[model samples]
Target: MTFVHAGHGATMLFMLLLLLGAGAVGAAVLSRRVIGLRILDYPTGRSAHARPVPKGGGLAILVVFVTGVPLAQMIWHHTPTLADKTLLAATAWLGLFSWRDDMHPMPALWKLGAQVLAALLVAWGSLGILPHDGTAWGMLLGRSLWLVVLCNVLNFMDGLDGLAAGCTLLACVVTAILCLHAGAGVDTWGTALVMAVAIAGFLPFNFPNARLFMGDVGSQCCGLVLGALGLHMANLPPLAHGWALMPLMLSGLLADVGVTLLRRTMLRRPLLQAHREHIYQMAHRGGMQPATITVLAWAATLCGAGAACALAGGVIGLPAAAGGVLALQLAWAVVVIRRVRHTPGLRW
Candidate 1:
């Protein structure tokens, strides 16, 4: 599983293979450890799986990320900046806490506090990633809020097998393409490529029928990195409409998570408590196959991401692209809600 890019040459391909091999093999070994230790996510009323499955499989992603990234970045054109280093450090802190939570569930406040701290660390050292014109205070606070939102939204959407990873895989590829078009630093696009392939390594065991789950460990990491990278690109001078387009490109996730959160909030549902009220969860309970749900999510994500790239690249006007993508997502929401509305254990 090697992909040769135009200028980056064999380095990118080699690193991709390195990460893929590490992620796949490491995930397999972690699965055995989880099984032996009885670290399993058993089926609950809100769960997407039917049986107990290995839960800490995301340890493999963590290993591949920390080890492969340093070696891969050496091959990339740009060296790691202060912001990059800071982001990685923050991520390490996050993973430590998340891994603990994966083993023994933590309080919601603790998780939120840790996530906010990580987001703030990136904001503090993110001169390269933030806009140069803004006041430092505004840059730190505003971007921190945005990244925090992204982290939580992304985490909320990671409910089913291949759903979160597939959506993120498509979004990452699109983001990499856009960063390339805008001449973003290699640190940016390189991270995107590595993250995509790393997830590719983990997808096989988790998708279709779950043999292992990325659990809290992988979901939090995915959320944090995607949030950080997206905000970094949104600050690029040439990437007009990027801030708006980022959310829309992830409309499948934003719509489902956002709407569900809003719905739950209005109904005074225990926000901290987990439940199977997301449209995907409802649809799964309504008898939709996991594969079909995953495919639809990926399709909608790709469509939105493509439309966003067109808008960012000036291939299409903002009005046209936004209208098309929004309408498509709106229609998607309608269809999903209509199909799953009748399912038990799901309240709108």
Candidate 2:
């Protein structure tokens, strides 16, 4: 739906600036603090980083992007709708519980349940993915499950430095640009940009022999927000909506994780077990530099997000944009899996 509450272009720009600056500073400061406190993550069998590194640095993002962005909206008197209010509460709860988990290990089921509850609140109480006219129970159920599953998968895919943060940044920025270009309302543009800038703050400390890891805190927080925002954009009122185009934003991630799981399952491997057989991980094991693999995955994300945008904006003549993106991701996954130049020395 077209929102017309007077001029918001300038306000939006100002908020973007605030989020970006705050996120970067918060991340840098929090990284130092975390390191000093010895809140570190040691390498494990299912791990990515080689050395111990500070974790829970995502609190900087929660403060600057998740909590701070909404606070700024309130200060600017944006008059948040119930949907916005729900988003605020949900983001906070997800970040809060995840932060708790970062400091002290929590039951896996508890985290999964929190994720499901967060998704349900947004999907049922706030941003209904289906319309109000008919029986949307099925759609809501599917959407709820989708949000929770995607949130976990995205969290799972956060296997390497800068991988999750960078993919999220790409998805948010591309979606925001597309929404703006399509003359979409401030809702999409504002939320997407806020997420992008916040992730930017955390990204620097991640990747390349990092200062810290986003840990489960950053991963889950970013995943939940990104999933919600994608749903928001996809469910935008009757007009100018593209529910089908939404998943393409994370096509690369979904494809890799999905394919990897299917392969393991076919081999009779326990599905619940943690392993490093993801295409990106395989690429890393195949002597590809972590940076190179991350860059390639990010490039795939860019292409997929761009295609999704094109589909959403009516630039594409067909409804096959999501398929196109998925095909690319699948092909990339295959290449990475097949091109292992050497067997992994580490117990994967």
Tens-digit lDDT track of model 2 for 1-348: 134444475666676576657766776686667667778788897676778888887777766666566655654556677667666677789888988898898888898889888887777754435456455776667767877877787778887778888998888887777667656655566777777777777787887668878877778778877777777766654324466555777888888878888889889998766777888888887777888888887998888777876766677733578668867876876677566744555433
Number of clashing pairs per prediction, in order? 0, 0
For candidate 1, what is the lDDT? 0.76
Give the lowest summed-lDDT range of ten residues in model 2: 1-10
lDDT of 1 by residue, 211-323 (tens): 77777777777777787777767777788787766776787787788888888999988888887888777777778888998899899898888888888877898888778
Q: Please list the residue runs of candidate 1 whose C-alpha ends up more than 4 Å from where it truly belongs after superposition.
A: 1-37, 128-134, 341-347
In terms of TM-score, how similar is model 2 to the real structure? 0.87
lDDT of each: 0.76, 0.74
In model 2, the Cα lDDT at residue 159 comes to 79
Per-candidate alpha-carbon RMSD to the true structure: 4.1, 3.9
Worst 10 residues of 1 by lDDT: 1-10
